[model samples]
Target: MNAFMKVQNLHKIYGDKVVLNKINFDLKEGEFLSVLGPSGCGKTTLLKLLIGIESQTSGKILLKGNDISQLNSSKRNMGIVFQNYALFPNMTVLQNIEYALKFHETYKKDARKIALEVLEQVGLTEHMNKRVDRLSGGQQQRIAIARTLALKPDVILFDEPLSALDAANRLTMRQEIKRIQKEYHSTIIYITHDQEEAFTMSDRIMVMSEGHVEQLDTPLNIYNHPKNDFVNDFVVKHLQTKLNDLEKCMVKDYD
Candidate 1:
């Protein structure tokens, strides 16, 4: 597939300090690409730049061969689902989902219909009448995703969306998100520090460090053939440790 979105020679600078250093990547349509890295690795900064919240010091952000790096956030036609869920607590799920659609000319006329459709897409139709604050974490997250879907964005960006959930809820939401992506035919850029989360959900994983991409490839290839010490130590070794711990627990259970 052709590159649906491209970030080339991207750089972000705050005074004398550089936050992102000549970063580059290509994203395909309807692909789930996870940006995996530890905290303060410039992953969040990259998201902000792509979404137009932050301007790149230098570089081009091309969407379908058009430069959109300078566009305002609202004009970018990209949706973001934050870790906090960022819903209106007092509003019902239906209202929260309908809120953003009012700003879109094409969707505003049929806001309720679109909202309900997205709510059903995320499997939160039954909770539509409930206040967002009254729902559990997982339900609230689905609402947030449903709200984003209502606008019918070209690309969806997730900023460590499941990091706030408990283990059970996180696992459940993972499946929900993958289903939504497939059914909605969305292109997603998921940001996460969890190796397992990236491995399970992403079509390809982009490993980053200190504002640079360490490796960008399939999860299996990254695991089997690491490009350098950082990729091996950060991604491979960490996943291996988790597997070793799981093996010990399984052996104990059998004994």
Candidate 2:
């Protein structure tokens, strides 16, 4: 299968500091790839580069074999959902979603139709005419997602999108996101520090640390056979106590 997106030796620098270092990866069409990392690990920076919000200091980004390294943000054909929802306070829920489709010359009327459908998918159709300020955090997050979907972009990049919601709402939204992505058959690059969220939502997970990718594999493989001490420590730190104890027993067999 052809890769829908590819990053080759990507590097990003902010003056004297490096934000991303020699990053390389690829996403197949309809794949859900979660980038798992702690804060300040450059995961968000990677998302920004993919969407053209930030430029890479070196290397190339290819979307379906077209180099998009110098493409304008608006031309990237990628949708992004930020942690803060990024909704316009004055716009109604439906209007906010419709805004994303304004640039698509062929889809003006269809945009509204699609936006409404996405709102319904997110359980926010009743809130369509309501201003963003009136909605709860979860509701606003759903609006953000709906807005992104309205663009019908080739790829979706989510930057810690569920971080601002409560636990219950986060869980609900996580499942909704998974379902929506599959429904659209969209390639997704999701960034989150939450291990459980990554494991639950990702078809594959890339563990990043200190501006580099430490490992990329299926969640089960990441948990069972971490490549290095850092990954092993992270797995132990994040796993439940029972699971941690089980890992110890499993490790003994390897010893």
Which of the numbered candidates is closest to the native, going by highest TM-score? 1
The deviation in Å at residue 37 for candidate 1 is: 0.7
Candidate 2 per-residue lDDT over residues 14-48, each given as its tens digit: 99999999999988999999999889999989988
Clashing pairs in 2: none
What is the alpha-carbon lDDT for the whole of candidate 1? Answer: 0.94
Tens-digit per-residue lDDT, 1-255, candidate 1: 559999999999989988899999999999999999999999999999999998999999999888999999998889999999999999999999999888788998999999988887778888889999999999999998988888888899999999999999999999999999999899999999999999999999999999999999999999999999999999999999999999999999999
* Root-mean-square deviation (CA) per prediction: 0.8, 4.9
How do the predictions measure up, each by TM-score? 0.98, 0.91
Best-fitting candidate, measured by lDDT? 1
